[model samples]
Target chain A: MISTKELSRRGFLNMGAAAGAGLVLSQTGLIRPAHAAAPLAPVKAEEALIAFGHTGPTSDEGWTWAHDQGMKAVEAAFPGIKTTYVESIPYSADATRIFRQFVSQGANMVFATSNYGDFLYDVAKRAPKVGFYECDGRNPLDNLGTYYVQHWYPTYVAGIAAGAMSPTGKLGYVASFPVPSVYSGTNAFLMGARTVNPNATLQCISINSWFDPQAATQAGTALLDNGCDVLFGIMDEAGYLQVAQDRGKKAVMWNTDLRRYGPDAYISSIVVNFNDFYVKQVGRRLEGSWTPTYELLPMGGGVDRDAWGATVPAEVAAKADAVRTKMMTEGYSPFVGEIKDAKGNIKVAKGQTMTEQELYHWNWSIEGVSGLDG
Target chain B: MSTWRLQRLPAASPLVSLSARLISVVLALVTAGIILAATGKNPLDLGAQVISSTFGSSFGMADLALLFTPLLYTGLAVAVGLRIGVWNIGAEGQFNLGAFAAAGVALFLPGPPALILPLMAVMGMAAGALWILIPTLARAYADVSELITTLLMNFVAALLVTYVATGPWLDPSGMALATTARLPVEVPAVWDIVHWGLPVGLILAVLLAVAFGFTRWGYEVRIGGSNPGNARYAGMPVRRHLITVMLVSGAIAGLGGMMEVAGTVHRLQGGISNNFGYIGIMVAVLARAAPLGVIFTALLMAVILNGGIILQPQGLTTQTVLAVTGLILFYAAIGDEFARYRLIRNAKPAGTR
Candidate 1:
C-alpha cells in the first residue's frame, strides 16, 4: 500500500498534497505550451529502451490502475521497449534514490506517478540523458515532462448525468483536498448539475485526503446526512460509491468504471484514457522532439465517458455523450462567461470562457458548490 | 489438563544458543520465500537484488549512509530508552518536534553554521525532550502507562507538526504542499557532501555506545531498566532515572530529525520520515537494546530496507518489502526468545534428533 494515501486512513496526513503542480505552473505561466504541436518520430524501435514506472499501486484498481494500463499499452505497442515498475513509492528522498537506481540500471525513460513529486526535478535535472515524466505532477524542469489527465472534461459530462438524474437536485461531492485540480473538477461537476437543473447544488466535503476508505465512508455519510442524493468522489477508491449503493442513491464514477464496486448506485464515470498521450510522449522522446509541457488531456485523447448501470437512464447518457462529442469536435468548455464563485462573485464575465491561467490558479469554488468554506 | 508442557532448561552452551538463533533466521527466510513463491514472485536471489541495488556501488554505499544516519540516532535513542525502562514510544513525535524546532531556528533565528548549527541541535533536542516532558512526567509521578501516554503524545506531535507545516512555518513557495521553509544552516559533511550529516551520526553513535558501556550513569540505568523494583530497593533514584532516560531518548531521537533536515533534505516536508522512529524499534529489539549493538543493527536494518527497494521493479510491492522485513524481525524476536528460555520437552521422544 502507498503510505502517502493509505496512511490517511489512520488520519495522520490531513493535507492531501496536490503534487508538484505548485512548483512552477503559475510561476512560469504556461499551462499549455504551443511547442507541443511539433511531432517527432520513434528512433528507439531498433534498440531496447527500458521504461521504468514509479507509482502507488497498479493493484490499487483506481488512478494507479489506469496509469498501469497505459504503461502496459505502451509496452505492448512498442516491441523493443522493456517495462519495469516500482509500486507504492512515497514522494521523498527514497524516491530520488529509486530514480537514481532506475537510471543506473539502464532505464532510458522514467515515469513517476505522484502529484507530490517536485523532487523528481532534482533527479531529472541531474540525469539529462534520461526522459522523466511526472504523471499528474506539475510542469517543472525542462528534463521533466508532466502529463496529467484532464478527467475534468469527463467530470463535466458526469455532472450532466448527475444533474439530470438527481431527483432531489442535491448532489454530494466527497473530494480529497481543496487543490485547484479537484476544485476545478468539482466546479465542472456543479456546472454540469446546473446544465440540467438550474437549482441543483453540489454539497462538497473535503476529507483532506486522497485514499482513506473509512474517511471516504464518513464523508459520504455526512453528505448524505445533509440531504445530498448523488455523490461524486475523486482519488483512487470509490468507497463512497459503495456507500451510495447501500444508501440506494446514485453517485458519479471517477477515473475508472467502478460501477462494479457499487453497481446498484452506478452513474456513468469519467474514465481516464492515457494510452494515446503515453504513446505520443514516448514517440516524441525517441525521435528527440520531446519538450516540457503542461496541458489538460487533449480532448478525448486522455479522458472518456463510460457507461453506468441501468440506474442511469439512456437519456442522461445521451446528453453526456452529446457534451462529450461537442467537447471532442467543437471544443466546448463549460467555463463560459456568467460563471460565479461560491460567494456569488462574478469570476468569468459573459462571452468569456475561463483561460488555462484562471484554471491553473483556481482558488474559489464555483457557484452551486456548498460546504467547502471550512 | 494438556499431556505436554514447556520446560526451561539451564543456560545452554554458547554454540547451542548461536545455532538456535541461526536456525531461526534460516527458518524465517524459508517461510518468507515460500510465501513469495506462492504469490507468483521469484524468491531466487531476492536478497542479492536488494544488496546489489542498495550497496552495489560507491554512490550506493554513500546513499546507504545517508539513509541510515537517522536510523542510527533513532536506534540509539530507543536502545538507550529501553535500557532505562523509559519505553519512549514517542520517538516519532520527538523526531518531528525536533524537525520543526530546527526549522524554527533556521527560519526565525538565523546565524552562521558555527552559531546556528549548535543552536539548532540544542533547540531541536530541547523541543524533542519537551515533547516527551508531559508524558514522562505523568509516567514518573502519576504512575500512568508510558506506552499509552507516549503513543498519545505522538499523535499530538504529528498534528502539531502538520499544523505548523501547513500553517505558520509552511514554505510560501511550496505550491500548496505540507512543507516547512528551508534551513540556512545545515550539518556539514566530512569526506563527501553526498553523505551530508552521516559522519556526525556515526561519531555520535559510537561515542554514546562507549559511554553507555563505561559511564556510571549508564550502569545505573541498566540496573534501573532491568529491574526497577531492585533499583528502588537499592536506594537508587528511580524517578530521576525515569525522567533522565525519557528526556535523553527524546533528545537523541530529535537529533535523528535534525540529521534529515540538515544533512539530506535541507527542508522539512511531509515525507520527511518514512517511519524512521518505528523502524528504530526493530533495530533496538534486534540489538537487544545495547547502544553499541544499536549501531550495527540499525545499519543492518537500513541495508535490508534500502536493498529491498530494488526488489520493487522485480514485482515486489511495498507490502512484499515489509513482509521481508517482518520475517527478519520475527526471526530476530525468536532468537531473543530462545536466548531467554531454552526449550525442553516435558517427555522426550525415544529417538530425538
Candidate 2:
C-alpha cells in the first residue's frame, strides 16, 4: 500500500520515461511516418468553402449532434465544396478570434452557431469578405445573416397535449433567462393550455442557464411542489425531462426532438429542425447567391409536420400528427382570431394572421401569464 | 606564453545555461509526442501543423500578438505574487474588474483629448488594485490564505459583469443579448497600432524584469520570499511588502484587462477572458518567475492557443491540443524541479561494516 503522493510521483516519473521512449522511437523512425508516398489531389479552387463554428462539441449528443448530421448531409450532396468547422469554441473572445482566423484562412462562408449576437455582429463587421450566419436573434447586415426556428407554434401545440393529458389542470414551465424566445414559447404554451382547460395555470421559473441539469431539476422539483402535474421547458435540454421522469410527471421538450434524451418521460416535443435551413443556406452559398437577411425557417419550410413532430404514446403521437396536419394542410394559424396581450389588450382579431412585420415587432406576452420582471 | 595554460571543459558545458534549456525543450517535445500518440494522432504532422499555423502568415502573426498581449500582463501578475511568497490566484477577477471599470469610464465620460485615455487606464489600474486589497489585507492581518479568497472572487466578478451587461450597462439597441453599449470611437487603438497592446505589454514586462534584476526593492523582496522569518528578523516589514506585491500584481492584471477592452472588444461582454488568469500561473511557473522569461513563455502559450484554433479545421480536436499543452506543462514543471534541486547519489549507511 503505497501512499497516494508517492504513487503520484512514481506515476509522473513513469509518464516522463514513457514520453522519452516515444520521442526516441519517433526520431529513430520506428513509428509510422506522417506523409504517404503520394499527395492528395487538389480540390477545385473556385468551389466555395463553408466553415461553421459550434459552441458545443460534436460528440455532445445534443445540439451540435443534429447540426453535424445536417453538415454531413450537405457534404455528401456537394462533393467539390469544402466544409470545415471548429467545435466547442466558447462563445466569447475565443469565438471572435476563431472567426477572424477562419476569414484570414480564406473561408468564403462562416456560420457561428451561438446566441452571442453582438459578438457575432462585431466579428462580421471586421471580416466583411466572409459571409456570416448566426443562429440567434435578428441582426442582419450586408455580410451577416440571422435565423431562428418558429418554435412558438409547436410549443403551444405541445402545451395543448400536456394540458389535455394531465389529470390535474396544474402545469409547470421551466424557462431559461427570460429571453424573448423563451418568453414567447412559454406564453404561447400557457395560452394553448388555457384554451383547453380554462382554469389551468402554469407555474414558471427562470433558471438563468441554458444547460445546467442540476438547476433545471431543482426548478422542476420546485414546480412539482407547487402542485403542477405536467412539466415542460423551453430549454431544449434533457434535464427537465429527466426530472419529470423521476417525479412521474408528463413533459414536453424544446428545440430538439428529444424522445431519445428522455425516452421514459418525454410525452412529445416541439422540435426545431435547424437542418432544413442549414442545408438550404449551405446550398445557397454554394450557388453563389448568399444574402444577408433574417431567414425564419418556420414549420412549413421545406420539411413539414411529419419531419418535426414526435411523441411517446401512440395516441399522443397521433394527436400531435393531427395538429401538425391541420397547421400544414389546412393552413391553421395558431395566432389567428381574438388574442389578448398579457395586459388585456386585444392583440389579434378574428380571421387575422400575423404578418412577418408583426412577428418581427412582437414584444408583448400573451394573456394569463404572470411573474414577468423583464 | 608560458602562463597560457587552458583547462579542459566537459563536451557539454554545464555552466552554459542554454544547454539545459535546450534539454528542457526536447523533453517537452517528447512529452507532447507521447500525448499525441496516446490520443492516436501523428506527432510529426501535429508538430508541423502547429508550427505552420502559428508562424506561416501575417494573419498568424497578428493572431499570435493578440493572444499574447493580455497573457504578458497576467504572467507578470503571477510572477509578482510568486516573488512575494503569496499565490494570487484571483488575477482573473482583478482583470475583469479592471475591464469593467474601464468600460464604465469609456461609456460615461465624454472624451477630452489624448490625456483622457491614459486617465481611464489609470482608473482601470486603481479598480484592479482595489479589488485585490480585501484578499491582501485578509492574508496580511487575519492569516487567511489569499489563494482561496482570490479564486472565489473570480466567480463573484464574473456574475457581477453578467448582471451589469444585462441590466444598467446593457446596450439598449442590442436586442436581448447580454452586453454593454459600445465605447465611443474616441477610445480607439492608439495611432492605429498593430496588435494594439502587445508592444506596450512587452515593454512593461521587460522594464519590470530589468528593475527586478537590479533594484534594491527586488533584492529585499527576494530575500523576504526565500526566508520570511529571517527577513522579519532582519527588520524588513514582511507583511507590508506582501500587501504591496499583491497590489502591484493586481494592478498589472487590471491594466491587461483594460487594454483588452479598450483595444479589442470596445465594449464589456461576459466572456472577456478565456482563463488567461489561470494560464498566467502556468506562464509564470514555466518562466521560473523571471519577468523576461515570462514574456517568452507567454508568447509560446499564445502560439499554441491561437494555432490550436487554426488546427481545429484540419481534423485536430481542441482536446488533443490541450492534452499536448498539459504534457508540455508537466515536463516543464519537472524540468524546473530538476534544474533547482541536485539529485544526489546514495550515501554509505552508518553501520555498513
Candidate 3:
C-alpha cells in the first residue's frame, strides 16, 4: 500500500523505538519484560511442584528441622500440591545445579531454606516464572523474596529469666558467627539481663558453625569452667544444654524445645514456627497473586520463648513473663537508645528507639558483652 | 600327585587391573541394588533415571566435567607422591592454602585480570608447596611419618579458613556469611556453567603423564620408591628425589584449589574443598598411581558423584550416597588384592612323591 522508501523509513523508526524502550526498561530494573506486564499465571495444585533446598539435615532438631515442619504444613494445607526437598545442600556450585534441577523438573516455586546468595541467584535469573524464597537472605530479585523471624524479642525474654536466676550474674553464650543474627541475639540478651541485674555481664564464644555439637560441647565446658553459672547458645542440637546439665548449670537453647536432652538445665528456648507463613505463601503462589516480599515475622507470631522449664523458679518466670506480656500487648520494643558498645562507645542516643532495619542488621557487641568479632 | 597353589605376582598386568575394576564396580552396584530393593525402592528405575539425567543433557555433561576437574588434579598429586614413596595425605591442607593464596591475590591485588590470574596460579602453587614444606622436611630429614603429619595439618587448615572467612575476610556488604566478596576475576566459562578449569585439569594430567613416563627424574623417583637403600647404594640422590616429588605433589593439589575458587565458586569460603582432596586418594589408588590412568579413574569417580546428586530427588541423602561410595571402594580394594595373585597347577616334590 506504501512506497518502498517510505516503508523502509517507517521500519527503521520502529526498530529504534523498540531498542530505546528496552534500554530504558533495563536501566530501571524492569529487564523481565514478560513479568513486567503481569503476575505469573495461576497453576493448578496437582500440577504445582514446590522444591526446597535445605542447608542442613532435617534430623538436626534445629534450623533445618523447623523448615521441614513448614514444608509438611504446606503439604497439609494444599492437599494436591507436591513438595520435595534436598537436605544438606552445600553452599557451592552444587547449589546452583540443584536449583537448576528444580527448574528442569518444572517447579512452580523453589525455596532455599537458607541464604544461598549467588548460588541461587544464578538459577532465579534464568527462571523468571518460578517463585523463589530464601530464609535469612539479604538480596531479593523480582521473582525472589526473603523471610526471617524477630527471634531477638524471645531471646531477650529468656535472658531476663537467666539474669534473675544466675547467682553470679555472668552469662555465657555459644554463638555460630558474627553475623547480624548473632549480634542482635547477644545484644538483646545482655540488654534484657542488665534491666534485671545492673551488674550482669555476658561472654560469647564463636565456634564458627551453626551445628557442630562436639565444638559446642567443648565451648560450653570452657564457659562453665570460667565461672559462668548459666549458658546460652545458638546451636541446632542440645550440645551446650547437655554440657550445662552435666555440670549442674542452667542453659537456654535455640530452634526447638530441647528440654528432653537436659530437662534440669533447660531455662527456655527461642522457638521458631514457620507453618502459617509457608502455608500463606504457597496459597498465594497457587492463586497467582504471589509477589516478592521481605518479611520479618514479629514476636509471638512466628517466634516466641518456650514454656518455663520445670526447674525454673516461679519468681524468675513471673519476671520474664511480665516483660513478654507488655511487649505483646503494648507493642513495646526494648531496643530503645542510650545503648553502648563493649568499648564504652555510645552507639544509640538517649530517647531514640531503634528501627526494625537497625535491629535486623545489628553487628556490634553491646556494653557488658565480650568475645564476638566481625 | 599334583597340587594347585596360589602364587603372588610381582606386578599386575593392565588387563588384570582393568578387569578387576570392572568386576568390583559391578559387584558394588549389585550390592547397592539389593539394599535399595530392600528399602522398597525400584533400583532399575533409579538406575535409568541416573543415566538419563547424567548423559541425556548438555548440562549434565557440564556438571560432570566440573566435578571431574578437581579430582584430576588431586589424583595426579597423590600419584606423583606415590612415585617417590611419600604418602602426602596432607593434600587437603595444601588445597586450602592454595585457594586461600589465590583468593588473597584476587582480593588485594589491583592489576588487570589477565596478569592477576597467572600470578594467582603461581601464588597458589607456592602456597601449597609451603603448606606441605614442614611435613616434607620432617619426613626427608628426621624420618618422621608424612602420613600422620600431613593428615593433622588438614584440621589446622580447615580451622584457619573458617576463622579468616568469618572474621577478616567476611563480606563487607553484609550479603554473605563465612565468605569473602565474590571475586572480580573468574576463569571464563566455556560452556554453560563449566569453566576453563576442565581444559586446565586435562592439560595438567597429560603433561604430568608425559613427565612421569618419559623423564629420567621419574625413573630415578620410581627406583627410589621401590628401594631407597638400593637407590642410595647405586649412587642415586634418593633424598633429593623425595623432597622434589613431595613438593611437586603439593603444587598440583594447590593448583586444583586455585582453579576451584577462581573457576567454579568465585569466592573464598569455608568448606570449599568439599572432601575432594580425600576422594582423590581413592582415585589414585584405583588408578594404581599411574598418571595417565588417573584420567579414567577420575571420570569414573565423577560419574559416581554425579549419580549421587541426580538421585537426590528420589529421597536419597548424601550420607546414603557416601555409603554406596564406601561399598565400591571396599570392593575395589578387594579386587586389587586379588589382582596380585594367580592360580597355578603344580606337581608334588619328588621327595614327597
Candidate 4:
C-alpha cells in the first residue's frame, strides 16, 4: 500500500535493526558469534587442545625436548587453550589407548610423532571428533594429516658442506629404521657429498631404533673404523655426535641442536620446528574451522633450515650460508632428476619434480641403501 | 637316656597377624608419601586420584579387569613357582610363546566357533609350557640358574614374535611397521565391557588356588618346598614335584598370553607382556606365595596400572605411580620380615656395671 521509495527505505531500516540486535547479543555473550558473516557459515566457537605423543620421556633433552618446546610455544601463543601430552607411550596397544584417552578427554587435535602410523589411523577412525596429524609419511586418511620436513634437502646441503670441509672423501650416516623418511635423508647426504667430491663414498648403518644412544655409539664406532672421516645421523639420538667427537670427526645431527651433546664435533644440524605449522593450524581450529588434509609445507614450513651448532668452525659458516640460500631460493627439491632405488631401479627420471602428494606417499628406498628388505 | 621330648613351635596369633598387616600398610603409605614429597607432589591427593580413576566408571572398571586378568595369571604362575622354590623369571617368555601359538590357532584353524575357541586356548597353554621347557631342563640338568635362563629367554621370545609379526605373520594390509592382522569379533566377550577371557582367567586362578590349598599334591609340594631334605625323608619325590610345579606355573602364564591374544589384541605383537611376568614376581612376593593373597595383590597392581593412565591427563607422570608401587612393595616386605623375626633389645648395661 506504500510508494516504492518509502517501502525500500522501511525494509532497509528493518534489516539494520536486526543486525544491531545481533551485535548487542553477541557483545553481551547471550548468543554465539560467527567467524565471518558473509562468505562461509560462521565457524563455531571452539577450544583447540593439541595433544603431542612422544615415544620417549621429555627429559631425553633432545628430539622430544625440541618438539615439546615448540608445543609449549603454541600453548603460549594461544591463551585459554590447552595442550595435553603423553610421553614414553610404547608403540603398541598402549599407544592406541593413550590416543583414545586423549580424544575422550576433549583433545580436539593430536600430533602422533612416533612411526606407529598403522595404529594411529585406526584410533583416528574411532575418534572422528578429534583431528589426527602424523609426523611420518604413511598413507593418510581423510581425517588424518601427515607432514614431514624435506629432510633430504637439508641433509644434502649439509653433506655438501661436510664434503667440501672433509679432508677424506669418506662419510658416515647412522640411520634409525629403513623407512622411506630415513632412507631419503641418507641418500640425499650421499648425493650431496657426490656433488662436491665425485669420488666420495658414504657408509650407512641402521640400528633399528629412533633413539638408542648405545646403539648409535656402536654404529658410529663401526663406521669410523671403516674409513669414514665425517659422521652424520638420521636418528633422533645425538650419540653419533658424541662418538664423532670422541673420534675427532665432523658430525651432522638431526631433530635437535646437538651442540650440547657433541659440541666439538657438531658441524650443522637439521631442526624440525613443528610449532610454526602447529600454531597456524591451532588458530584455525580455535576458530572452529579445522580441516583434515595433508599439510606438506616445503622448506618454508619452519623446517629445512639449519641451526649451526657450536662445534661448526667459523670458516665453514660462509659456505653453509651459500648452500642454504641456494636451497631456500632456487626451489631445489631432493627428489628432482634421475634417482635410483636401493635395488638399482630408476625411481625418478630427469626433469621430473615430484608432487607434494607423491612425496607424502613415498614407499621406496633411495639408491645406495643396503640391508633393507623394502 | 630314658626319655626325650620335642617342642613344637606355637602358631602365630590372629591379633599379631592383623597388627602386622595394618603396620605394613601404614608403612607403605608413609613411604609413598615421602617419595611423593620428594617428587614435589601431594601424596594424599595422588593416592585419592589413583583410587578414583581406577574405580570411577564402568569403563575404568573394565580396564582394571582386563589388566587384572593378566596380572592374576602371572601372579598365580609366580606363586606356584615360589611354592616349589623355583624362581621362574621365564613367565614372560612363556606368555609370549603362548600368545604366538594362540595367534597361530586363531589365524590358521578355520572351524566352527565351538571347536576353534577352546582348542586355541589349549594350544596357547601348551605352547607356553613348551617355551619354558628349555629353562626348566637347563635348571634341572645343566645346573644353569633358572633366573638367568628364564630372563634371557624373554629376549629370544620377544624377537621371535617381532620376526613373525614383521615377516610371515604380518598383516598384508598392515603399515610398514610390525603388527598382525585384525582379530575377528567372534572371540567371545566375557562382560559387555571387559573381554570374555577375563572371567576364564579368573576362574582358572581360583581353581588353582583351591587345588593348592586343599589337595594332597598341594600339601606335598608345600612340604617339599619348605624342606627338601625332610620331604625326601618322608618319601616324597622332590625332583618330580619340582618339574610339576614349573610346568603348572608355565601353563598358567601361557593361558594369560592366550587371553591377551584371543580376547584383546587378537595378534601376537612384540613386547605384549609389557613386563607382566616381572610384575607377577612382585605380586607373588607381596602375597607370600599364597593363592588367596596372590589374587588380592594382582588386583592392587591392576588398579595402579589402570589408574596410572587416568592420572596422566591430570599432569601426573607414570613415575609417580611407579614410586608409590615401589613404596607399597617395600612396606609389604618389611611387614613380612617383622612377622618372621621379633625385635628384642639386649639388657647389657646392668651386667657391665
Candidate 5:
C-alpha cells in the first residue's frame, strides 16, 4: 500500500499539471466547458434585463443615439423589463470586464451596440450560457451574432429628393470611411439620383472619420466650390449641410433628423430606428428561437426615408414619398440588374440583385461618382 | 492706487497644503452634488451608489486594480518628464508604439512563454523610445516646440495603429473593425483582474520616487531642465540627461501599453490609445510631479473611472467621471495656487510708503 504522504504528493502534482493545461487552453480559446458558465434558464421578460451600448447614450449624434433609443424601446415594449446600459463604453480591454460583470449579474442577453465582434466572441465563448448581439460586427460565434441596418436604400430615396431639388447637375456626398457601408450608401445615392436626373454626377470624398465637424465642413466647402448644389453625407452630425445653408444649396442628412441644425438646407435623411430590431431580438431570446444570424435588415425593415425638409419642394417630396412607398410595397432591391462598376465591369448582372453577403464586402464604387481617392 | 496681487510664499507647508487639498476635494464633491441635483439625482444616494459599485464588491475592486495598472504607469511617465522640466505630451503615441511592438514580437516570435513575455517587454520599451526619438531631438536641439511636436505625433501614432491593426498585422479571422491576434502566452493575474502588472506599476512608481530622491542622475536632470546653462557650465551632459528623461518617460508609458496588450486585452488595437497619456498628464499635474503623489492620483482616477462604468445603469456614465475629474482638477489647481501664493492688497505707492 502507498504511504499517505506519497499519494497526496502525486495528487497535488496531477492537479497542478491539469490547471496549467487549463490555463494554456483558455488563452488559446480552446478550453471549453472547464470554466464556462453553467447552462442558464432563459429569464422572463418581466425580470430586469441589461444592455451595453458602446459610445454612451447622449453623444450628440452618431450610432450612440440609435443604440440608446434601442435600450429605451426594449424597456418600453416590455413594461416589466427593467433595462440598463453602460454608456460611452470603449471598444477596448475594458469591454470584457464590463461584459463579465453584466453576465455575473444575471443579464440574460447583453447587447454590444458597437463593432466589437472580437470582444463579444471571446466573452461569449467563455461565458457560453450568455447570449450576445453586436451591431455592425462580423464575428459569428455560437452564442454571438451581429446586425446592421441597410440604410443605403433610404439614402437612395433621400438622393431622389436631392436630385429633384438640385439646380446644378453636380451633387456632394461626404463619406465617413471607405468601408463597405459607405460604398453601399454612396452607390445607392448615385443610383437614385441618376433615376431622377439622368445627367446627375456625384463628388464624393471620405474624411476617414465619423465625428470631425471642421473636416466635414471643409469637405462640404470643397464640394460646393466644385459646383455641387445639393449636399448629403454620412457623419455624426449634419455639419456638411451648414455649407448648403450658407450657400443656398439643397442638402440631406444622415442618421438623424437635423432640420433644426440646418434649417435652410435640410431636405431629407436616412433615419434608422434600431428600437424595432432590439425589441425583436429581446422577444426572440425570450421565445428561445434565437440563433446566430449575421443579419442586415433593409430600409422597410427598420430604416425610414424621412424626406420632408423645406428645401425640398412640396412636389419633389410627394414624388420621393410615392417612389419610397412603391419600392417598399414591391420589395424593390437596392442593387438592380446590370449594375456596373466604375470600370464598366458587371457588379450585379442582369436579372440578379445583390445579396447581403455581396453588399457587406463591397469594394468597388459604381460609375457617375468621383474616384474614392485611391 | 489700490491693487490686489498675488505674492509668492517663502515655502509650501506640507501640512497646510494637505489641508487645503482636502478642502478642495470636499468643495469639488459638493459642486458635483449640485450638478447631480440639477440632473435630478439625490446626491447622497448617488454617492452611495458610486461607492458601493466600485468599492463594495470584490469584482469591482479587481476592475479598479486593472485600470490602476495602466493609469499608474502613465502617471509616472508624465511625472518623470515633469521632474526633468520636459513636458511630454506624446505618452499616448509612445504607448501606441509599445503596444504595436509588443504585439509584433508576440506575433512573429513563438518561443517559450517565459522568454517571449520578457522579450516583448524589452522590445516594447525600445519601440516606445524609438517613437520619442524624433520629437526629443526636435525639442532638445532644433529649437522646435516639444508640446506641438509631441501632440502632433499622437495623430501620426493613431494613423500607424490604424494601418497596422487593419492591414498587415490584422487577425485574418477578425471582422471589419480589426485587431491583431491575441498573444499565446498568458501572464499571471492578480485576483483575475490582470497580471502582476499592477504591482509592477506600483514598484516602478516607488523606484522612480527613490531615484529622484537619492540619485545623482536625478540631480543632474533637475538642473539640466531648469538651468540648462548652469548644467552645461558645470560640465554636466545636459543633452544626454535630457535624452534619458525622454527615454525613461516614453518607456514607462510604453510599458503601460505592453501590460494592457499582454495581460488585459492580449491584442494590439487602434482603440488602445484612449487618451491615457493625456490622463497621465492630469495625474502628474495634480500630484505636483511627485512620484508618490502620482500613485495616489492614478489610483483615485482609476476608482472614479471604473466606478463610473458600473454606475452608468443608474445614470452615472463615464462622462460623470470626466465632469468630476474636471471639477477636482480645477479645485486642486486653485488650492495649490493658494498654497504657493498669498493674495494681498498692494502697498501704497513707493513715495507714500
Candidate 6:
C-alpha cells in the first residue's frame, strides 16, 4: 500500500495536460524563464476581482477551511474587494479551464491553493497582467508566484510535546504520501522526539491521500496495535485524533486547532492561518505593488502550533513552548547536522546545518524512521 | 359506460422518440428551475448566462468541441455494444489502457511521428481489447455476466494507470508530478483548440452506421443479440459473433483514449478519462444505441457538461450538476416508456357484443 501510495502521490501532484491542441502547441511558451516581471497595475477595490481555486471544499474543516478563512480575511481587510472561489478543483485540464475562466471573467488576481503545475502555468503565460499565487508551487513565472508555510517548525514543537507525553517512546505517523512535505514533517518530528529519548523510533503508514478519514483511522489502529503510544500525521482531518481519543493514546494533528475532536488525545496541531498573508497580498495587488514573490511563511507568522490541548501536562507544554520560543526569538534551528538517514549514512555532516531549501525538499527518512522508505 | 384500453407499441416511432427526448429535457430543466427558485437563486438568469457563455464566445465553443470529441468516441463504443445486447461497462478501463499503451509508444518507441502515430493507435486498440479479454471470454464460454466482469476491470485499470503514471513513467522534469513528459508528437489542430480527433471520431461513427445498416455481418450480429437460441438453431456462429462484437466495442473505446492522449492531453495522467467512459453509457442509452444518433446525443451531453462548468463560478457544485443530469436521465427514461403506449376506446361492451 505504501509503495502504491508513493505512486498515488505522484498522480496527486501532476494532473491535466489532456487533449487540446492550443495548449500543447503552446507548450514551448510554458518553459518561460523565471525572470521577474513588473508589478501589475493597481485597480479600484470595488472593481477589482480576486478568484481562488481550491483543491478541496471549504467545508472540509481542515486545510481548505484554513484557506477559506484567509479568503474571508481578505474580504474583511479590503471591504469593497470582490472575492470568488471555486472549490474542489481537480488536477486536470479542468483546472486549466477554471483558471482560464477566472481570467476571462476579468479577475485581477487569482490564487490556486495547490500546485497546479502546467495547468496554472498555461493560463498564467497567456495572461501576463493577472497576478497568480499557487500554494506549495515550485515553478514561478513572471505573473505567477508561490507560497507555503514553514510547517516543519511547528511540527517539531508538537513532536517535543509528544516525546514527553509518550511513555513507550514509539511514534506512529499516518502519512498521505512519501512526498517531500511528508518526508520533512516525519524527519523534523522524529528529530524533535529523539532529543527527549534517543531510542525513539517513528513508523509511518502512507494512505495515498491527503484526506481519507477511514484509511487514517485504520492506520492509527494498526499503529496502536504495533505498540505506538503517540500518533502524528499530515492529514486534512481529525480521523486519527478521534481514534486516539477512543483508544486512549496521544495524537498530534495538522491544519487548524482540532481539540474539539479529541481534547484529551489531541496534543497539538500544526495550525496554518493564511489570513494575514492573503490580506497583505491582496493589499499589494490593490495598490499596484504586487510582484511575483516566493514566500515561505515563517513560524509564528502564517503557520504555528495550536494552543496545547487541555489534558497536556503543564510541564510538557512548557518544555515544548521553550523550544518554540527559542526558534521564534533567537532563530535557533534544531535541524543541525550529526543527522543520519535511515540507512545509517551521515546525510548531514556533524558541523553542517541543513538549509531551508534542503529541509523543504527532504525526501529520505532519517535513522530510526521506518515504513516511509517505500 | 365508455371504456378505454392502453396498448404498448412494438416500436416507438422516430418522431415520438425525438419528441420524448426533447420534452424530457425541457421538463428536467423546469424542475431544476423550480428548485433553484425555492433556494432564492434566479434560475432564468442562470440559464441565460449558461446559454450566452456556451454559445456567445469562441472559447466556449472550443471547450465544447474538446468535450464533444471524447463523448463521440465513447458514445459510439457503447452504442455498438448495445446493438449486440452486450454491456461494455469497462469502457473506462479500456480508455485508460489505450491512453497508457499509446503513451508508452510515444515515450519508448524510437521512430518518426508518421510511423509511431499509427503504431500507437494499433497498440492502444490492442490493449483495450486485451483489457476486456477475460470478461469477453467468460461471457462467451462460462456464461458469466459481462456487466459485472467488465465493470470490475475499471478499478483495476485505473489503479494500473495511476501506478505507472506516478511511478515508472513519472516526468523527470520535476515540473509535472502525476504525468509523463509531454509527447513529442500530437494530433494537429483543425481549429483554435479543436483537434483532428473530432474529425476521426465523426468518421468512425459514420462508418459504423454504414456497416450496421448495410452489411450481412451486421444482420447476423443483430439477430444473434436479439435471440441466441434462434440464431443457434439457424446455424449462426453466435458465440464467435459475440466475441468479435465485444472486442470491437472495446477497441472503439480504446481508440478514444488514444486520441485523448495523443491529440488532446499530450501527456498521460490519472483521471485523464474524466468519467467520459461512464458518461458514454448515458449517451448510448439516450441515443437508443443508434450509431448515427450518438453524434447528436454526444453533443447534447457536451452542452450539459459544459453548462456545469460555466455554472461552477456561480457556486453550483459538481454534485449538484450531476443531480441535475440524473434528473434529465430519469425524465428521459420515463418519457421513453410513455412514448411506447397508445390509448384506444372500446367499440362496445364485450358481453353485449
**Best-matching candidate per DockQ:** 3
TM-score versus the correct structure, for each prediction:
0.85, 0.81, 0.92, 0.82, 0.80, 0.91
Q: Candidate 6, residues B1-353: lDDT per residue as tens digits?
A: 56799889998888988999999989988998998899888999999988888788988898889889989988998988888889999889999999999999999988898899999899989988998899999999999998999999999888777767766787755455567788888878999878998999999999999888899888888888888899999999999989998999899889899999898788898878889899999899899888989999999889888888887888988787778778888999999998998787777865684
Candidate 3's error at A180, in angstroms? 1.4
Native interface contact recovery, all models: 0.32, 0.34, 0.43, 0.19, 0.42, 0.25
Candidates in order have lDDT scores of 0.72, 0.70, 0.84, 0.70, 0.75, 0.84
Residue B175, model 4: Cα distance from true site in angstroms: 2.9
Clashing pairs in 5: A56-A88
lDDT of 2 by residue, B140-236 (tens): 9998999899999988887777668755786654354667777773345533324457778888888888777899788778878888999999999
Worst 10 residues of 2 chain A by lDDT: A23-32
TM-score of 5: 0.80
lDDT of 3 by residue, B42-131 (tens): 999999988887899887888788889888888888988988888888888888888999999999898999999999999999988998
C-alpha lDDT of candidate 3 relative to the true structure:
0.84
lDDT of 2 at A148: 65
* Candidate 5 per-residue C-alpha lDDT over B43-89 given as tens digits, one digit per residue, 9 for 90 to 100: 88878866876777776777778888888888998899888688889
lDDT of 4 by residue, A73-156 (tens): 787887767788988777655566677667766688888876665557767876666767777634455456666666666777
Off by over 4 Å in 4: A1-49, A116-126, A137-144, A163-170, A197-208, A305-332, A336-367, A371-374, B1-23, B38-40, B104-120, B163-176, B181-186, B341-353
Alpha-carbon runs more than 4 Å astray in model 3: A1-38, B347-352
Task: For each candidate, report its DockQ versus the true two-chain complex.
Answer: 0.33, 0.17, 0.43, 0.12, 0.35, 0.31
lDDT of 5 at A77: 83
